[model samples]
Target: MKRFQKAAGQWLPKMAKLRGVTAAVVASVALSGCGVVNHMVYKTTGDVLQGFSRNHTVPYLLNTDDLAMGCAMSEATTPLLMSFGRVTNEPDQIAVMLYLSAAGCADEQAREHELTGLAALGDMDGDAAEDAMIRQKRAHALAAKRYFRSWQHHNAYYGEPGTGECPDFDDDLDEFIYMAGLLSGLQALNAEIQSTSAIGVPKNVGSMVGRATSCLDNEKWWGAPMALRATIWAMIPGAMPEGENAFERLEMSDRQGEQAGVRLSHVFHAISAMNKGDNERLRDVIRRHAESIEETPSNEDWAFVDAMSTQLIVAISDRMWVENNGHRTPLGQLGTFWDDEQEDVETMDLDDLL
Candidate 1:
């Protein structure tokens, strides 16, 4: 009896401890993985459900705005999509970051293009415009390369937003937004090639930009796609069809944004002026943006994305301001200079510390 009691006493506490630890671990996983599991289940089930509803119910219901959301859901959902992409490496999922990054490349090009344009527009005594134009051309060349990098990814992973039978608004918004950025990238490339023909760069974008239009329903979509079509008509070297004026279309897009109470058209205008290196126009547009927001701050319903964009363009002005005055943008800069804030100290000799 004593021997039996000793064995039970020895094992009972250890068994209880093991049970307690296992329960805690299970609780932690269940709390964290609830979201993960729910997303997988919903996505899997949604795709299965899409098979049945492809012909009738899906198209009419989903077409009001992209993805049938009143506000931008992509801002919130993109992180989740990115995490899933990293784990699965699925083509479509992986394409999300690739496409967005492509947009980022175009954004970068706009900044550099502005700088080159500034150089080009300067009145110099000897070969000033010519020198600046060459640099501008090179700038575009690099922008084109980034655009090409994006295009390669698109060709590999971008699925058409719709099938022959129905529009896939779910995936279409993601794909087409990337396409919008691509069109700008292509136009930037075409311009650079024109400027630097002596370098034997290919000046061919009409076909590529024209071909892109087929995949996107530009008639139904505005903003970036409309800007793209306008660019196609104006810059693609007689690529415009009969009776289509690119400038009119561009103005019409601007008007559309005005009527809609959101001047997304400003971003396009800024990009164009930057390509031309016309600082006056860029500054004017930036001022208009600041004033517009002040006038109707509440109207811009998608606060995060639109605000983030304004911050990016404002950075350009900050860059100029810093160069001329040796100070940063007013109200601090985002992802820019911090050297001023850091304390300057003499480095210790190795012997002093070691």
Candidate 2:
């Protein structure tokens, strides 16, 4: 009996120790695998969700006013500012530091500089506007624009490219530059209209300004160039007949030419609001317009819708720093637009956008 007891005691202790060691090893393995599992999930889901190709085309519809939201108050003012240069160094670093300082984003620094420079340029208080001051103002604005573009580029890359993924250049910025250029050209024309007496200004300058201004002012549903109206209506579907889907209304109008116009307007406004950092308004407008369209069961126009919606979202979010200003800020403390609600209710996906 003593012999049996000794053997049993010895076996029990050894077994217990072995079990403890095995448990420790198992726990260690599981802890190590946790990281691998996490990585796999991130790769499969996160990457797949945002894997869209970088679309780099300018949205066709946004007008100069919308484009200038990032650079100046109106389309008319963009050139006056761009005559100054853009700021373009260490944009990401500048933006983050500015954010940390609670000083707004770096993208806006250019616009602010341009504005102050312009205000300083004419010395709005000066007895007469000197050529040197005008040149200085233009120089400052140009510098600011460069910085604005750099900041925008950096921010876009920071969000999507960090994943070692696709290049995500913003189309809205390109459009803004394009629109700014057009407006600058217009301003020169306007200047000649006022001061250039040595030679008569080209009639085309007067005609272009008149047309561009008309594009900005007209609000009629049927009378204006259908392209402009349709484009505007697309971006802010809320502007359409209250109950009907703007797209459907356009489709039913069977006026393809007009419908195209409305689409162009929508694109332009979406691009404009984007540069201005007006996300709430941008989202609200898209949501309203999206409600009216008949989404398809199969072979949906999802690509186009998704591309436009994504561009709208990205554009607004990209320049969020500009939204918190006196002139650009919404009407009410909790407001969206300067005068009236200007957008529609249609949404697009970031992944599928053009």
Best of the candidates, TM-score: 1
The C-alpha local distance difference test score for the whole of candidate 2 amounts to 0.36
lDDT of each: 0.52, 0.36
| Candidate 1 deviant stretches above 4 angstroms | 1-93, 102-146, 159-172, 178-181, 184-203, 214-222, 259-262, 273-287, 298-305, 308-354
Q: RMSD for each model, in Å, please?
A: 16.7, 21.6
Q: Which ten residues in a row have the lowest lDDT in candidate 1?
A: 62-71
Give lDDT tens digits, candidate 2, residues 1-354. Answer: 999999999999999999999999999999889977876665554333222111221122222223223223223322332222232222232222112111112223433443343443344544233543444344434433333343343334343211243233244342233223323333333333323222232334323322332322233222223333333444442444466443443333323213323322333444434434666645554443343222321112223322333333333432332333323233222223344566698987888865
Instruction: Candidate 2: list runs displaced more than 4 Å.
Output: 53-105, 117-354
Residue-by-residue lDDT tens digits, candidate 1, 1-354: 999999999999999999999999999999879979987776665454333333333233233323213123333443444344343443343333333444444445555545544544443324665554456565555555545444544444544322232224456545444564455446445545544534332345445555565566543443546766666565456777899875566566654554444555556666656655777766666666666656555223334334444655675666575445544456733333433466688987899777
